[model samples]
Target chain A: MPVPDDRKQQPKTTADAKIPGAYEGETVTRRRFMTASAHTAGGIATAAFTLPALGMAFGPVFEKEQVRWEAVGPTEDFPDDTYIPRTITLSPGIGEVGKSTVYVRRYNDTIDSEVKDEYNDYVAITSRCMHLGCPVRYVEASERFICPCHGGVYDREGKVSGGPPVRPLDRFYTRVRDGIVEVGPRYSLNSELRRFSPRDPGQAIDGVGQYLYPSRPSIRKLPGT
Target chain B: MAKLPTTSGTRPRGTRAETTEAPATAPQRNKLQETGVSTIDWLDERTSLSAGARWMMFRKIPKGTNWFYTLGSATMFAFLSQAVTGVFLAMYYDPSATRAYESVRFLTNEVFLGEFVRGMHKWGSTVMVILIFLHMARTFFFGAYKYPRELNWVIGVVLLILTLAMSFTGYLLPFDQRSYWATTVGVAINGTGPLVGPYLSDFLRAGPEFGATTLARFYAIHMLLLPGIIAAMIGAHLYLVARLGTTAPPWIRAESSPELREDSK
Candidate 1:
């Protein structure tokens, strides 16, 4: 829509009111010059204070996920299809070595044909329960991981089978190189994997699962699927 | 400097009567009092600070303004205590999933007065919550949220929400088992909201799951964003409180209705 002639003339009217004797081509007045200078100074001042502070505050956020491959043990040491609890040292980007336990299970053959990594045969699930971070212990008789804090149970595939947990147990990225099993960073299970099969890479949570088990704000992408 | 005033009574030495009358030998007008008055006068002349001070300190609150009015001040005091202790804690806190728990442990076990400061920050938050609740309750019971003061009430509610957010975000900084799981649940709860729920949770946690980014985000919110918001809201709240004046208790207003009618007449 075209602007009305009167509305278009508003700036001219205000300029005339401010400087009655001056025309458009006249030299800038002291008041206008000072006003422009003041605005520039204000912008500079604001940027000077804000930019560095913002950088300092949000610097860590842009940092790439700091991951180092820590060897869990030899692949031959783990029997096929059995959960072995092992402690892994995680650095997590900060200059601190943190120890956490992961339940490592080695499959005899290729778990997925799509991803051709030899390490895909292993699954390293964090011991931290999905419900409340309590250490979940594997119950051999029940064939499940049971949380002591809230009775949350995860099946052998780390899918939540019963009680309280909104999602499956968190899993770490695993790799096997030259006969040794090593784990990288830990990642939460996507919603598709809540009832995941041992063979599936697990779908990323979308649609109803997005509503059911919302994905946590993660530094890294979903590892497996 | 001359000797300070010996008497600690409410009677200030520069009373209008004493300044004007000046009885034969007024004990040299206490040189210390003279200096204090002159200093205040100088400031008053330059900046009119006395008017601002009077505006702030000499408001005529309703006769029914009792000890309940102190709740707001108590909440402000608690917030200040938290800020001071939080600053000290921030000096040693590492807002990373890897170092957060360890740093807290070090503060508690190693740093001088670190445990005490942490305890103060924790308890101060509890006290702030309690005081803000009591203050809100008192405001509601007195019908202080009516008409002219409605905006102030709304700002108070916002402040209350921000205070809770501060507490919740601060809860995860310890990065313990309890904090981690509780935060997980909290983020999941955020995801339960309609439309933006998942996005909001992801935004808050900084990605798809709680980790280093989540810790950094919470730390920034708890330490900087929330505090800055609360402070601005508090300024607005106080300005509104001063502009509108506090409400008298309903009973007192009812009892004084006759006097108010007569004065109007």
Candidate 2:
């Protein structure tokens, strides 16, 4: 559409508004150029703003699968008591690495005959807190794991009792191959290898494998009048 | 010069135009020595830039104001410091069972400046955490969080939480015994919430329990995720600080002296 003669005849502002330049015929306005430049800059700014988040949000989606573990301990030597604090070194992926300690507790209990299998007679747990990560201390007096930072407490079975921790303690995979005990990746109840194979009855160990303690009989035989 | 036309359609046929110019009415002008107010007008017309605006939006800041503010800036510096160090570490960090431990060993022993840089980054995180909290406390005690500054306080709160989360997430990256157990407790706590507890726990670990996936998830979150959020929050915080203007010294408002009032009067 052609502009009307009267309106089209009006003088226009130049790109630099403060100074008026003489134009014999047509002229441009400062506002028009500013608007165009601003739009272009805005487009550039918007792209700059959105690209980084997009890159970070999607970059790791197709990363390779990694699964590995460090040997925590041998089976028979750990004894039937709580495993003390110790770090296990492992390489999880090509360049990835980690160190973790295994907490295992074994006590005297009769094994059910129905679930007997060849694995091992032991249970191990990892002590990492699920909340804002804090070292959880196993309080012997309370028989619960307690994190001092946020006061997160867990029951003897590693179940959450209180505080900000978000989940139960993780358990490591344990098995007896030959006589040596080894722990695999931390496993759960729903893992592919179902529940750990049950152990045989204590009597099946045959007395040869049992170690007799001098304190046992002496402690029982208190001084008599 | 050409004679001016009275009208194109109706002009007088005969003589040249006469100058009746209204006798150039005597000009009325003020000449009362000018009051020397020319100085004031001249000053106004000069259009010199206000020092405050010039100093604020540009100009090099003095060393004095730069002193205490360095704590916050240093806290930011430490974060960048951590990022550089962390990147170096991520190059060697393994988020799995097999390589996680070895990679840490390589970082600690094999890589150049690896141990020192990692230690600095680790310690820097602690310092950053402490400084951020201190900055918040300073802002609070100084009443910097009052009035128009409330949004800054709220953003500060979010940043505080992000800092703690960063620390928590970073703790697990080492995959140490302490981290493992700490993360377990972390997971268990999430499990205790109403409704989606179990699902949240599973989701956090990326499975039914902590595994290779959990380690990977945590590494990504710590290294790549939370930092991004923190950077945004910091940018907002600094921008707000710039907009709100720094809190002034209280003595400026006390106004106790009568002489001062009289002087102003």
Over 4 Å off in model 2, which ranges?
Answer: A1-225, B1-69, B249-265
Residue by residue across B1-265, what tens digits does model 2's lDDT show? Answer: 1222332235464343353233334422222222233333344334533443444576443223434455667778878888888888887787775667678888899889889988988898999899888777667766768999999899989988988888888887776767776776677566444444444555566544344567777888888788899889888987787777666433235435666565544
User: What TM-score would each prediction reach against the true structure?
Assistant: 0.72, 0.47
Residue range A44-72, candidate 1, lDDT tens digits: 99999999987765454344545578898
Strongest candidate by TM-score: 1
The C-alpha lDDT values of all candidates are 0.71, 0.58
With candidate 1 superimposed using the best TM-score fit, by how many Å does residue B101's alpha carbon deviate from the native?
6.5
Error of 2 at A145 (Å): 12
- Put down candidate 1 lDDT per residue, B114-136, tens digits, no spaces: 99999999888998999999999
Q: What is the lDDT of residue B175 in candidate 2?
A: 67
User: What does each candidate score in C-alpha RMSD?
Assistant: 7.1, 20.8
Q: In candidate 1, list every pair of residues with a backbone clash.
A: A216-B208, A216-B209, A217-B207, A217-B208, A217-B209, A218-B207, A218-B208, A218-B209
